[model samples]
Target: MSTIYDVAKEAGCAPSSVSKFITKHGYVSNKLGNKITAAMAKLDYHYNGLARNLSTKTNNRIGVIVPFLDHPYFQGLVNAIILEASKISKEVVILPTAYNANREQQYLQELEHNMVSSLIITSHSLPYTKIYPYQRFGKIVFCENSNHQQTRCVFNNRKEIFEKLFTTLKQKEITNFGFMFIRNPQDSKTTKETFEAFKKIFNHYPQPERIIYNCRTAEDGKNGYLKLKRTIPNLQIVLSESDISAAGAYQARGNSDTLIIGQGNQLVSKLLRFTSIDQHLDETGILALKLATEATSTMKEKVNFDIIWR
Candidate 1:
């Protein structure tokens, strides 16, 4: 492998001059730059980005910390972030933690070590106490709601959206509805907001049997629909966590006249011709990257959302 020293020897220039030319950190004369370029072409040399980043204390890479990769919701968000980063000439590194606290902490430590310029945490198991200390290392942006006032986030305004959704549903005389979740109500603020919104509009909390937990895939949604059917035979509607899950319910409800509402307005929702709430994931991702790269205030930015009834 050709190193910087090899390029320097071939170019007959100081290694520092070669470094300056390659990293563009300091000025190098046009003649020295041309020589280094020729030397690199002859030696087929490739500079180490990690080493350069360490020396310059700068990075063009942004890390996105996600909890799960199998779910389409996260997959869509990642794709949006990657596309947005590419437009700005930035690199994206996806770090999956599977909701593991230790793994999340390790990825956060990467920021502390300057391995990543900034991090966009889609979800995490670590508390703010452990994660906040590393803010001194780099910008830490959240893709979901945050309790702390000091943190920066770009999230869907689920509370406002849910309130409007339930109000609309109630006006349509839709009652006896159930909802699915990837996490328990206590663990996710979104789920809690959903519950509150349902209670406010329906004038009562949904029965425990109507709530489905640990739902991430189409299979989970199919099973949840079947389970709810057994309990509440007259199930009128099921609000799915994602369009992927909603597709399952759409398939399982074969001849039933039940309404299947989904979130995220994913491709499946369009193809399956089901109703869904479009959370504007693309916009959220774009804004999250902007927040990480630019000087943004430490406040929660809510992505606009709308319902698509089919």
Candidate 2:
């Protein structure tokens, strides 16, 4: 009936210190080590290995909640998180919420309620407010708001991508152009930054109003392309926020005469011969794992990931 909590109190040490001794996880002073051992024996404690480890030490469970796993972007990031977590001493429990607030909330609740030790959340549908309650329970983090000292923001720089993209456009002397992007919420930090960069370079030129489209599914590529076609019917040159969006535009209208550049070098972008920026999926995921390890291993401060675009 005695839990680690009971043993820790009896040992006159924090639960984490007791956990370190039990799991042989890290260095423990001779005094603390002896205290923990004595507490365990007195309490007749039996380490069920995995169970107690889950509830006591690392919890061995890391939560990953992404917007839409169906998107190659998220899929790649998840792969990195999984691979990195695998290399360490913990296990990952991924919860793909498909950008649903209710779903995101449910996953967060379930992780805490079920005693998941740490969580790395990438919420595209749900805002950060949903996870505010998790600030104290453990290491609750965001993958897109690194500005705050406590909340981790994992992302890449769009300035470099934008700079290269604009240079290409300028070389071709394409004075008039339009930006193809979705509405807000779809407006990620990179998206907004990219738009800002675009305006800086092209605002002076007489270009048409920004062509925005909303996509419902990966299949929305067709619908998105149709919308773009209807507007610029001959929409020759445009910069799209996502690979699928650019591919959709290509699907509705082939890239024969169009210079449609896509961000996020997804497979479709390659197949469609659309130029795109590689957000470094493997690197991003690896960094995410590094953040989780540091946060879980030491719940001190939010980690900062220096993002670069290639």
Candidate 3:
């Protein structure tokens, strides 16, 4: 491989001059700089990013940790973060962990190693206690509602929104409810809060008939509908974690009076003509990136949500 020495020799200058021009650390005459640039182009030289980052103690890259990219909610979040990052000439590295704690820890290790400047955790399986130790590496921001004192969090009032949804259903005279969630019990704070809110509102109903757990995809939603139909014969309302799942349930029900409410007002929800919670996930993504870059005091920023009634 052609080295800086080769480029310097080709440009008829010293290696220090070539290094100064490439790293922009010191002054190099325009004439010599042009020669070095021409020589580098002739040799098809590429700068070693790892070596540069190691020497500078910085990188123009941000690491985002998400559960998965298949869901529209996550896609929207990632896209917004990427868009915002691009405006500042930064790049995002998405690390999908599929709710694996060990994989999340691996990404934390990457942060510690200075592979990226900071980390935006959209969703993580690791507990806050385990993740807190890594703050020494770089800025770690949570994109979900959290009470952790170690990191800044940007999230919506999901519990309040769920209460509003339940109240809306009650006002519509709908009692028999079926709730679909993406995460397992105790796996996520949102899931736990949502279920608790559901229980609080529907305390009179049987627990088994009211929940459809692990509804991560559209297929799961369809199958969950089938199970709910067989079990809860008089089911009047269905709420799903994502619009994709709600679309599946809407397909299974096929033009019924059953009220379907979807979380994440995605395109599928609009096409399916169902009411959905617009959590402004794009805004969440932007805020997450901002917090990760700005390094504010450990704080929580709550974004409002709206019900996109069809």
TM-score of each: 0.92, 0.69, 0.93
Model 3, runs deviating above 4 Å: 204-206, 295-298
Clashing pairs in 1: none
Model 3 residue 192 distance off true place after TM-score fit, in angstroms? 0.8
Q: lDDT values of the candidates?
A: 0.88, 0.66, 0.85
What are the per-residue Cα lDDT tens digits for candidate 1 across 167-271?
988889888787888987766766888888877877887788888999889999998888888888689999988888888888889999999999989889999
Clashes of 1: 0
Write one digit per residue (lDDT tens) for candidate 2, span 189-280: 65566666666776652244445555434456556556656666556676666787667766766535766667677787777676787777
**Alpha carbon lDDT of residue 65, candidate 1?**
98
Candidate 3 local lDDT, 1-310, one digit each (tens):
8998899899999998988898888999999999999999999887787788877889888999999998888999999999999999998999999999899999999899899889999888898899988888888889876676656889787878877877777777887878888875578787787877766776743376668888878899999987888888788888888899998999898766788889888888888789999989878988888888874664677789888999
How many Å off is the CA of 10 in candidate 1? 2.7
**Models sorted by lDDT, best on top:** 1, 3, 2
Q: Which candidate is the best by TM-score?
A: 3
lDDT, residue 74, candidate 2: 73
